[model samples]
Target: MRVTWRDHSPHSEAFDDIYFNPLHGKEESLYVFWQGNLLNEKLAGNVQTVFTIAETGFGTGLNFLCTAQSFIGQSKEAQCLHFISVEKYPLALTDLAKSHTCWPEFKSLSDQLIQQYPPSTPGVYTLAFLEGRIKLTLIIGDAASGFSQLSAMVDAWYLDGFAPSKNPEMWSDALFQQMARLSHKGTTFATFTAAGAVRRGLQAVGFEVEKRKGFGQKRERLVGRYLQDNIPEPTVTPWFDLPSQARPEQVVISGAGLAGCTTAWALAQRGIKVTVLDAADKPAQGGSGNPQGALYTKLSVKPTLQSELHLCASHFSLNLLRQLDPEQTFWSECEVVQIATDDAERTRQQALINEAAYPQEIVEDGSKDTLSKLTQQTVTHDGLIMKLAGWVSPADFCRALLNHPCIDYVPDSQLTELTYQDGMWIVQTAAQKTYHTSTVILCQAEATSQFVQTQHLPLKPIRGQVSIIPASVTNQKLNQVICGDGYISPPFRDHYCFGATFELKSTSLEITDSGHDTNLHNLAKVLPDLAADFEKSKHLLTGRVSFRCSTPDYLPIVGPAPDPETTLERFAPLRKDRKWKFSNVSASHLPGLYVNCGHGSKGLVTTPLCGEYLAALICAEPLPMRKPIHDALNPSRFLIKNLIRKQI
Candidate 1:
């Protein structure tokens, strides 16, 4: 994670290039990359559409900064710019901040980039600037893996890898093939190297190559354009490739909870009008009605579908929550302490710290004494501290999301049935009133299973109850949220919220005295010191109960709603072979119908990103996360797995 700085230049001890031209890095970038790739012309050509630029290397981000400056200076025809770059080994934030100071002209932009630079986790990190007109997607991994996972149609390429002699792996034939896969017929690329291997590799991938005058001391550079007369189409696994309908002008979202409201805001940002319907009398009157909810990434030692999605969601959640609640009234990044109650948990926490390579600012190892000092409370065991994890008022956040001008939140409008006809979905309410739209997203939690079409989806309702404890003046020093078997929040407005008991196979919303006792028991197990104070005031405990829609594996079900009968018939061959091959099996969706539910206990951290994913699917934008994460959240995944095992 450290960048070795030599002579004020960031030298990659693992690769080549001083990251920039030491003599004049800014000028070299503007000339060789900006002018060489004709970014100004390409950006200006797309009057209203997004002009995408892909880079093989994004060392100190000099190329991106210069390109952003160029885009801002371009003619009025240009609207937006998307820069996607891959870096195998990322420079730490401190090093990035130091290297960026060399370019005083880019001071403002550099400061913003440094402020939002993500942790050293190897996944895609998205950042926006210039009022969302210019976007950057930083892929922190090897070139081929990053490019293969990228989900965008690129318009230009910044082949700024280290010299072909130093980092040939980045300029390999496989990399060129992936580039070709993401490019269109007119996609152009430029690089500082003119090696034969580079030229042949690009040409073999269908690009017409040429030699050009290089900038600075270099004599020549390689430039090329994708010119195959018959451009190949970008393809995914046929089963997962859902055909996208035209972006709807008006969308109807069921359930005005966290998922629905957030999705509404995301679509509204793209100028789409949204109508949010809820069965309750008000927004967040369901599972999201909680007084406070915690936010943190559910990570494991090794990357799995759930872990990857959790990591991706955690990053997206922080960036988005900050944007929406700039005043920090609805949520607070007050940090969280996850107490390790047993040796198993302590070892798991240690493995997470040592294996993930996460930035300390995001998550770090902590001792019992360190946590005690942080919370100003005595701790019996060590724990993992996530600096960014905290709590949010879900109801207030939902209200804020629905406050957008483009979103119309209708309360007490329960959707009883859905019928698709004439290329539009008709949503009928219990009152016999009907609403029609080209798109409908069901965010109605486990109640979504009541519909015959979605009955097969593996969704269950788990009842959860949280007991509220009045914080005494003596406990005012408890300044951080603490968690173990259950969680306890720091004093918030004369009281602390804690002790949530998860009850599976229960739909009852009645808060019981026994539930509060169970919570007290959990608190005693996690924090005995706090439990002693709570026990003396047990008579005053009050609580609330709600039901959360959960999946067996705990991952949320997002994306388009599949047609049950058709899907089973289409994938029937899976009964014989787990890896059944099918051609052109476009996703059999209940057209214009989608669902975002079953987020379970992680809705606060997961739903915001799930909202963005649903919005991207509807708007046909580049997905916020990679394809594998999408597959994990696919509503059809359970059915596919069962079919493969011949269980249905």
Candidate 2:
């Protein structure tokens, strides 16, 4: 977003108005939003543990910064401040830091925010501060569209945007309707505008709004609470509805790889006890054991479910990595240069950049010369340089996530049977040991299908091999991670990890010589000089092989496990007439059973975000993604599709 500065004050160029009161921006934000919504008094009490706030325009983040600081010092009990804000034109990182210079008291908190700020792009960027006590979800999109996609119940609202006359479209009935849909009976709202159109628009959407004395030069403002949920919400297929589960006290998680460890970390952060059962001797012995895995995604030319997931998950994972390793020792932000290896791929890359399918900060056009210059070596393709990606140590990440005191790791305990009685699941291991919990989450990739409830899940195993070799003998060092059909990670721990061959037909876990041969051949095609160096030292060749569980569609499954017998019987009429609406009946889910698997090769990018989504659902908190995207990742989607086609 372009901003014009007038004597150290921020002004929006698109709306042709000032961002806040120039002389009293801090005081004005506190008076209008903090006090208007009664945040201090509400936060000081122990009635609620999580106080969620939603805002319209996050022009300079003035309201958010004020509330974050206040919540930290004023709250008597430990509480989390969940702030969600929407913006179409997000400020650039440099400009955001520049704008915050006006407030010196928030230097420490503002610095943390700057460190976690995401690129100016359209995605859900959630940042954490004060050790998870505060979470800021920044949705970079239109005000109404962003709110419509969210599935949340807001406690307070900061309805601060450009003046109603300046940005008339944002202050319409459509926006207010969404506000009412996301608000409960006691949800409160405060706005800096007192326009009659806004008051009437809010009243038309079930909000009891009234005018109050305005801040500084302004004469009047509006404040109110949602009296009821009278606004009509869009209809959703009942089968895709998210089933409610109680806040789990003790949880059992199978497998300790990325899926398991990440979920364990998410739960442990909320003061929940988790037991991670692993078949192997320790964590990261499965698909997550690779020495190095690149944090990247191959964006599709056309927008598809996979592309949407990749775009959003990539952003979420990057932020997660930074939070995990702030010093950048186990990971590197050197960026991934995804080369378009052929003319067809080059054309697709051009289309992706030219059509502006993504924002400029996420990706840009690249040339062969640019690739060579970035890597400091010979390269052979023009590709899209992805700014939001790099490489990470999957093994280290899993270990760090499982290091929490709240997580109990069980080794060599392969799951044997699961029995449900008294509303609790009993998990029995091969060692004849049993554990009980109210909730059981299956993160054991393909092994989840061993159970009757989740056996219908269409999870397939794809074998992959990554060959690791010592540093290249070439004088030039690999400056960044590079990708073609496979990826090559930069030097770390005295070795250059690269060459992951995708084998669809192979199931054996042995690292065959032929697998290394296929990887070397592809490396030769992409970078001949590096291949020659590796060829000179063939005796040093070594690799690891693992199987990635994936579904027919590439999206990861993250939701309740549906009971196939009852769910199939309930929606059986869809096979006779595809237009049939089973709106009254939701899918029958196995009580307290959830599964998070089928990530395939994108586990590094998709696991953490999906884990967060599952944790939010279990805790009855706001979701972290769009509604359609959440449904697209549902495990029951394939069942519904198959029933409609009479294939199951």
Candidate 3:
């Protein structure tokens, strides 16, 4: 999206300002939005909890910055702010930064926003400012669709779209209805446009509209309050609506792998004490035990639930890793080469490069020459290079997360049965150990479904073997993680972690010669010199094997666990008729049971975001992501989809 600059005013090249004036942009925003919405009063009144504000357009982000400045000035130190904005045409970072230069007072804030502004992917992107007290969720899509998928009850709204005459699509009745759906009884809205259509649309949606003196040269603007007789409820699909529970002070999480440790850490941040139970003697003794695993995200050319989640997780986890390993100990920030091994892979790579429009610092296309230079070896095919991707010792990553004082790690305590009675969960382990808590989170991968209550979940166990090949003269030259049919990590210490052959329906951890041979062959296809050296010294080869838990769909399951018997009976109408429609129904969840499992291969990238989301749900805080994302990862998605399709 390009902005044409004329007479020191930024105008959208596409919509031609749509009867909206950008002249005196900052001053106009302060008066029309800040003053019109009465934000000072709202923030002061809602001092104990989060104050949420929403906007129709995020053009240049002037409204957001001005509101942030006002919030910091008027609110107490403990107060939090959440700003949700929707934009169809997101300007490039360079354009946004250039436009923000008009206001010197916002330079510092503008710079930080530009730095964290996400790529032009059509999904929700979250950014934090003011040390996490001020959060912004940017929905890069049309106002109607974005608001439909949003999951927040707003206190104020800055209806900052173009003039109704210029861009009627944004001011349509559908958008107003969505606004009403996302508002409370007392929600207030302010807009520069005083169009009769806008006023009628708001009134139709139960808002009491009023004309106000306009800012600058304009004669009048509009401000209104939602005066609906009843509070608006979440307009989510019946199958996807999840009722949050009253938060518990203590929780017991099963599994001590990446998923478990990350979930524990997130809960600890919210002052929740946790007891982690693992079957193994220590953490990271399963799939997370990989000595060196690549931190690569699974991307798709077309935006899907999995792709969007992966993108969000990739950005978040990379930033988190940098913070945890400031010294880069056990964590390497190196480029990852995802080579195009065949026609399908080449097409996928090209589509990702052309369609994703990722920032150069995140991902970009790498020609054969560039790939050769980055890997210090010859490559025949062009590939996508994740510039921020790297490798980490999973064990180290888990340890860093579990070091929190609020988390208690109980090892070699395999949970055999889960029973809920009298509002408390009893976790019985195989070693005759019993632990009790008001809340329980299952993060034990495939074993998450082992409990009688969760046996209906469709989780698969995949066996994988990784061969450790000693670093040779040529292997030592490798500079980063490389992948084609398989992945090869940069030399960790004395060896390069190469491998992994995936075997389905297998849980055996036995290291077989054929697995090692398969890995050698995979390596040979990409780096013949390194393979030859490994074959020459085959006796020195060693390996580790582990099992990964996966769902039928690759996306992980992260939310409250569903009560099988109750859910099936409640939604049984779909068993006879697939087209059956239900209204205002929520998932039948077992009171305090949650699960975060089935990440499979992208665990390193996806687990951290899942952790944050799970924590928010448990603590009854505003969700970190949008509703569509939550629906995609809901643990009951499989069951609900099957019922909807009449597959049960």
Best by TM-score: 2
State the lDDT of candidate 2 residue by residue for 1-648, as single tens digits. Answer: 899999898788999998878788999999999999988777765476678999999888889999998888887545788899998888888788998999999898899888878767566777878767788988888999999988888999999889999999888788898898899887999998899998998888788888899998789999999898544343557777787877888899999999999999988887789999999998988888889988878887766667767777887787788888889888888778888778888888888887787777778777889878877778887877888788888889998899899999998999999989998899999999999899999999988888977888988888999888878544447868888878888888988778788888988888888888888888776777888888788779888998888888878888998888888998899899878865567768888999999998888899988988888888877888888888988888989999988998
Q: Global lDDT of each model? A: 0.82, 0.85, 0.83
User: Given candidate 1, what's the lDDT at residue 462?
Assistant: 85
lDDT of 1 by residue, 506-586 (tens): 667888998998898888776787888888888888889988888977889898988988888988988998665676666
| TM-score of decoy 1 | 0.95
Relative to the true structure, candidate 2 reaches a TM of 0.97
A best-first ranking of the candidates according to their TM-score comes to 2, 1, 3
TM-score, structure 3 vs. true: 0.90
Estimate the lDDT of model 3: 0.83
The most accurate candidate by lDDT is 2
Q: Lowest-scoring 10 consecutive residues by lDDT in candidate 1?
A: 229-238
For residues 1-648, write the lDDT of model 3, one tens digit per residue.
777777665677678872135467778888999989887777767744568899999988889998998888999776778899999988887778877877789887787688678777677777767655787888888999989877677888999877788789999999999899888889899999899999999999999999998887789999999997555464445666776777788999999999999899888866679999999998999889988998887567767777777777776677667656768888787888888878898888888778855657568898888988877787878888886578888999999989888999999999989999998999999999998888999998988888888888898989999999767634348878888889998888777888899999666778999999999988877777677888888888899998878898788989988887777777888877766767766678898999999999889988988998888788656576778789888988888788877777
Better of 1 and 3 by lDDT: 3
Q: Is candidate 1 or candidate 2 better by lDDT?
A: 2
CA-RMSD of model 2? 1.6
